[model samples]
Target chain A: MKVLNEMSVNFESRSVNEAFARTAAAAFAAQLDPTVAELNEIRTAVSEAVTNCVVHAYRDTIGIISMNIRIAEGNILIVKIRDRGCGIEDIPRAMEPLFTTSPEDERAGLGFAVMQSFTDKLTVRSKPGKGTTVTLEKRLSPRLSDV
Target chain B: MLLKPKTMFDGKVLTVYLSGDIDHHSARRIREYTDALIGELKPVRLLLNYSAVSFMDSSGIGLIMGRYRMMKLYGGSVSVVSIPPALRKMMELSGLGCLDVLEGGNEENESA
Candidate 1:
């Protein structure tokens, strides 16, 4: 797929940055002229991805979380969030709804589920002891103004 | 930024007014504060007002689930009120709606 526009950002894997990451993604996706619902979905997906990096990936210490946003052809918005911390041992199990590693922390384990529900496509690539990368893709609805 | 939740407690019910974004960062603080109140008040019912919540994700689900568990331990029940339309899908996806925690239907209740 041809990329129309792209932006990359790296920030500390802190919970506070979760809002920043998602808001930045939404701002970047605004070029697609997404509806309110589309914009909200993107923000929620990005928040879940970044929160994973902060809570699960870098559980014990602070680390760097890198996010890349791209607008691909056909008005598709692609978001990539990466963390160079403790990676997932089993991607499939981790993605299961309500399967949280940190139950003690009151995590409902709905992060992956929410992302999947909100986005058009969800991809996870990880290696234990290496890192994790989550890619979210959503096709924006074509607006009448665009037509 | 942490949005402090406003709480009102009658003898039998505790209402928590939650606003702004409910993400991991904010959820932690809110959980801690609200849990303390639940421990102290021990209301028969816990009502969470989401009329002003602008954004939420899975963290919001976690918050509700945690509160539900807490209330259950105290022989109390939990219900959500005034969920914004934007967050209705999230509540549905998390099966909170199935649990009947959504006080009224999915309609946005501004006056709540």
Candidate 2:
């Protein structure tokens, strides 16, 4: 897909940045003229991804979390969040609903599930001790005006 | 930023009014404070008011599930009220509806 627009950002994996990252993703996605519901879905998906970096990836210490957002042809919004912290040993198990490693922290283990449900496509790639990258893609509905 | 919750207790019900965005960071504070109140008041019902919540992700679900478990341990019940449309969708996707904690409309009611 041809990238019409793109932006990249790197921030510390702090819990506070979770809100910032999601809001930033929504702002960047506004160029696609997504409806309120669409924008919210994007924001929610981004929040879950960033939160994983803060809570699980860099569990012991703070690390840099990188995000790349691109608006492609056909009003497709693609968001990629990556962390160079401890990678997931089991991607499938991690994505399973209600499966959380940190239950004591009150994690519902619904992050990946939420991301998958809110976005059209969700991709997760990780290698233990290497890193983890989560990509979310959504095709915004065509506006009547555009048609 | 973590916005403190406004809580009220009426003998049998402990109502917590949660506001602002509930992400991982804010959820921690809300959970701790709400749990402390639940432990102290030990009400028969725990009402979580989300009318003022502007945004929430899975962390909010965790908060509700934790509270549900906590209340169940004491034989109490947990109910979520005034959930926004976006948040209601999130709750449904997370299968929180089965718990039967979701109640009432999106607008904050005077009775609550």
Model 2 docking grade:
high
Q: Model 1: which residue pairs collide?
A: none
TM-score of each: 0.96, 0.96
Candidate 2 backbone collisions, by pair: none
- lDDT for each residue of candidate 2 in B1-112, tens digit (9 for 90 to 100): 2657888888999989999899998999999899899888899999898888889999999999999999999999999998877787898887888888988575445344
TM-score of chain B of each: 0.90, 0.92
In model 2, where do residues sit more than 4 Å from their true spots?
A: A144-147, B106-112
Q: lDDT, candidate 1, residue A41? A: 96
Best by the lDDT measure: 2
Q: lDDT tens string, model 2, A40-135?
A: 999999999999999999997999999999999898999999999999998999999999999999999999999999999999999898889999
Give the 10-residue window scoring lowest on summed lDDT in candidate 1 chain B: B103-112
Q: Please tell me which predicted candidate would have the highest DockQ against the true structure.
A: 1
Question: Per-residue alpha-carbon lDDT of model 1 for A94-119, expressed as tens digits?
Answer: 99998999999888899999999999
- Model 1 misplacement above 4 A: B1-3, B105-112
